[model samples]
Target: MANNTTASAASASTALKARIYKAPEKAEISGRSIFLAGSIEMGAAEDWQTVMTNRIAHLPITILNPRRPDWNNSWKQSASDPQFREQVEWELDQQERCDVIAMYFDPNTKAPISLLELGLFAQTGRMVVCCPDGFYRKGNVELVCERAKVPLVQNLDQLIDKVIEKLTEEKA
Candidate 1:
């Protein structure tokens, strides 16, 4: 029993230290990075990105999460704004360079940016999408996934599992 408890504790500690690429100022490392693109709208208290990071922390990779915990939607949408430009540019570059892009559309929000990202990388053959039935444009996302052959999941758990599968396949 003590052995098992010690093993679990070690695992949890390692997971807690998992690298999360949230700011562009961080050093760019060479390794598989999973760019997490998803819904972030008003009143969204669920931090799916953190859940995902913990789930896959054992893997030797970085998780690029674009959702800021303190995001302000009212910020100007132009690139001229320093903060806006940094966030946008970092996400775009991370998406392009990442080994896999995992996108999820929370049923409660429209997730317009996620939709655009799905369109942008649907054909990359390196994307895992989760657009639950309740999303406003589930049909469109489904069609795109079908035509592009992107693996789609039904929920957050499935998304994490699929991502793990992809990472394992890449390693093998």
Candidate 2:
């Protein structure tokens, strides 16, 4: 009976520790919510997303990724589809609920949809940050970012630092 009690207590203690040390479901991004808008087809976007996720994990803000599965599945279909419009609207709604927008624009391909999303975010007067491919410039994306007043960042390190600075300034 004593051994059984000891085993139960050990299991309970282990479970408690597991719960205590569990990582949060969503990373902190300061008090502000940021929408991650990027070209989902490019490999660089995935790398940037991973870096951004790690950087955001330590902040207090919420990061919203519309490219995520739960946001919509219309991206899998043709952009001309009527359902795509609905999805775009829904994503715009999500963007409205956010405080800022961060986008990854690789110069190799013109990400038309990302530019559209940037336009919407800009129309709302939200802050926009663009991470462009380091190798190339002078793309149409530069024009959009310029018009939107989005700061272009060269790398993930720069982006992380800038985001932190922006969040701190906003709090001040």
Output the number of the TM-score-best candidate: 1
| Model 2 score (lDDT) | 0.54
Per-residue lDDT of model 2, residues 1-172, tens digit only: 0011211233332331101000112333335666666666544445455456545544555555544333344355666766566556555665666676667765555566776776666655566455555524336556766776677676657766776677556543
Per-prediction TM-score: 0.85, 0.62
Cα miss at 27, model 1 (Å)? Answer: 4.6
Count of steric clashes across candidates, in order: 0, 6
Give lDDT for model 1.
Answer: 0.76
Per-prediction CA RMSD (Å):
5.8, 10.5
lDDT scores of the candidates, listed in order: 0.76, 0.54
Query: Which candidate ranks first by lDDT, i.e. highest?
Result: 1
Q: Candidate 1: RMSD over Cα atoms?
A: 5.8
Which portions of model 1 show Cα errors greater than 4 Å?
1-17
